[model samples]
Structures are given as structure tokens and as C-alpha cells.
Target: MITLIRVDDRLIHGQCIVRVLADFKIEKIVIVDDFTASNPVLKNVFLLATPPQAKSVIFSVEETKPNLLQFIENNENVLLLMRSPTVALELFKSHPQLKMELNIGPISYRPDTIKVTSYTYLSTEEIEAVNEIAERRVRVYFNQTIDQKIIEWNEVKNLLRSG
Candidate 1:
């Protein structure tokens, strides 16, 4: 089963491999990104970053659509990683049977993006995508590491409303 679905701009980096994998006891890390799927060099870089014990694989959204259920429905604990809320939203939309918890990890600041939390920044479209995901009954939270305090979906909504 998919243990966690995370959105981080830097997908499958040191922090993700070290913290999330170990803490969650994840058996596999499935990265769904078009760019990484198509670029062998980038895919190898992400794969190399992961430890030997953990299974790491990269698949584009389209590549995953047909066989996503088979990939995630197994008994093994899997962590689904995506680089953006847009992609995460798309994946969730395509595979509605996925886990309900959507964790928002590091989102690099862009000029047009607003800081929702210390680690998360979002553009207007991203904000809308997040809202749409929540509307689908998926709970979204901001978490960097497992030990940190979680910022729930309502808090993000409040931040967007206040800002």
C-alpha cells in the first residue's frame, strides 16, 4: 500500500532518503515526474541518492496511470513522491484509491509564490490545486521531517486567506 504521498520540489534527496524512508520504514520510493522519467541522467542521480535497501523507481504520470493500482496496492509499504502540487494533484486525480494523506514537503520559493509555511511556498495555481485536492477529501499537511509539528490543511487555508 502507499504509506505516504509527498510533494517536494527536490524529489528523492538526502533528507527524503534518510528521514522519510527510515522513519516510515518504506519498502519502495516511487517518484512520478515526467522530466525525471525521460532523463536518464537525472533519474540515475535520484536513484543513486537512495540507499541499497530501499527500492527506488521513477515513472511519469502517464506511465503510472494504467498500472498505478497494481504498483501501490501491494502489501509492501510505498512512498509516492512528486515534485509539485500540480503533479501530486494529477496523480491523486488519476488514482483516487491512493492514501488520503498528502504531505507537502519543501517547495522552493519562486517570485510569484507565497510562503505558506517555513518549508512550503505556492503560486496562485498551486494554491488552487491544493484546494481542489482537499475538496476531493484528501487531507493535506506541511511536514519537513517526521519529528516536526505538522501544519494541517486548515492552517494552510487560513494562511492563504490571511495573506
Candidate 2:
């Protein structure tokens, strides 16, 4: 089952391996991203970065639609990490059955993206994509680590609309 779903640009990093994985007892990490899956070098980097004991799979958004259920059905705790809210929104669209709250991690500062929160930022398209998900009643919150304060999506959305 998916114990945690996070959108972190850095993917599986030190904080992820040591904090998120350990706290959630994540046995596997399913990274849903087309760019990462298409590039073997990048895929290998993510695989190598994962701790030896934990299994990791890099699947394109399309590939994940069919296999996501199987992964969830398997008797193992899993952490589903996406590179962006856009990707998570895509996954949720195809697999509506897989309903879980989304944890917004590091969105990373980009050239044109607006800073919604310290670690969460959104571009024009990203904001719309996230709003689509929020419309579906899926809870999205900004949280860097297990200890960080949770910032609700509505609060962030209002901030975007105002500024």
C-alpha cells in the first residue's frame, strides 16, 4: 500500500532516505516520471541513490496507470514519489481508486515559478494542475519532513490568487 505520496524535485535524497522512508517504513519507492524513466543514466542514478534494502522503480506516467494497482496490492509498504504536482495529478487521474492525501515537498524555484511557500512553488500551469486535483477533494499539503508544519493547499491557492 502507498503509505506516503510526496512531490519532491530532488526525488530520493538524504532527507527522503533517512527521514521519510524510515518514518513511514517504506519498503519500495515508485517514482512516476517520463523523463527519468526514458533516460537510463538518470534512472540508474535514482536506483543507486536508494538504500540497498529498499527497492525503487522509475516508471513513466503511462506505465504507472496499469501497474500502480499491482504495486499497491502487493504486501509491502510503499512510498510513491513524483517530481511534481503535475505528475501526481496525472497519476491520480488514471488511477482514481488510488486515493490518498498528497504531500507537497520541494517544488524548487524555477525561472518563472511563483513561490507559494518556502519549499513549495508553482508555475502558471502547475497551479492549474494542482487546483484540478484539489477540486477532486484530494488533500494536498506542503511538508518538507515529518516534523515540518503542514500548509494546506487552499491557503497556498489563496496566496497565489492574491499575488
Candidate 3:
């Protein structure tokens, strides 16, 4: 019973804690980020940011599949968060049985990355991965918050190709 699968570089932040929690009755926050999960200090920071009523845990990308199986078995209402489109692509590849939509938000500008929109950014590799995900019949859209306008990948696909 996963409610949402979100990709935000800033995994758990003030805005996300406020916006996502308000829109979805998220019972559990599962963060899948290798670095964040392995770092004691950063891991505690993300966990501490979780709402009191909602349970939270962090796992490496390699560990999410088995955990997701249990979450499904228990019918847990989950909000799965991860860092990048690459991670999302990996998840889709690893768990091909999953039928989930992807919502992307706030990938900060970095070297070799193209600014797709105000909040969304992508490298050439990332853009290709995104297209690959969409080709797999997954609905992939970009929205900063639940209330904001959702920009479908198709809307930007051609624009990116011309450039």
C-alpha cells in the first residue's frame, strides 16, 4: 500500500515534511539512499525529521527490494523517498513487478546537469534513464509539491531532444 514514490535530492526536508505529509496519509517514510543510510549522523537527521505519528527508516538501494516485499505483505502505507532519477531507474530495474508512478522534485543544479525547470534538473545520463523509465510504462512527472502543476515527461521530451 505504498502511497507515493518520490525522488527529491533533499530526501527529508522541512518543505517535504510539511507538503507531503499534508497531502498523503503517510504511515511510514522509507528513504533509500546509500550514503545517507550508512552515515550515522545524517541518517539520524533524516529520521528525526520524520513526523511523530509516522514511522521512518533508511536503507541502501541494494536493501529496498526485500523491505518493500515486507511492506507490501504488511499492507503498510509507505512514502518511499530517494535521491536521484538514477536511483529511481535502478529501483524500477530491480523491482520490475512494481507498478508505481514517479514524482520528481528539487534536483539542484550541478555541473553537467540541465535545468529542466525551476526545481527539476537532469544530466544527459539521467535524462536517458528517465526516458527509459517512461518507456517501461511508468507515469513519470515533475512537481515540486503535491499542489503544484505536474509536468509530464512527454512535455519535455521533445524539447530536450531538439537541444
Query: What is each predicted model's overall lDDT from 0 to 1?
Result: 0.88, 0.88, 0.86
**Residue 131 displacement (Å), model 2:** 0.5
Write candidate 2's Cα lDDT for 40-145 as tens digits: 9999999999997799999999898889999768888889999888998888888887756889888789998999888777889988988998888899888888
lDDT at 42 for candidate 1?
A: 98
Which regions of candidate 1 are displaced past 4 Å? Answer: none
- Candidate 1, residues 24-98, lDDT tens digits: the string is 999888898999999999998998988887898899989878867976779888888898888888988888888
Question: Which has the greatest TM-score?
Answer: 2
Local distance difference test, candidate 1: 0.88
Error of 3 at 139 (Å): 0.6
Model 2, total clashes: 0
Once model 3 is optimally superposed onto the true structure by TM-score, how far is the C-alpha of residue 61 displaced, in angstroms? 0.8
Q: What tens digits encode model 3's per-residue C-alpha lDDT throughout 1-163?
A: 7788888999888778888866888889889999998899999888888888788989998888777777655676788889888888998888876656999888988899998988888999999989999999999999887778999998988999898
Model 2 lDDT-worst window of ten: 91-100
- After superposition, which runs of candidate 2 have C-alpha atoms over 4 Å from their true positions? none
Q: Positional deviation of 73 in candidate 3, in angstroms? A: 3.7
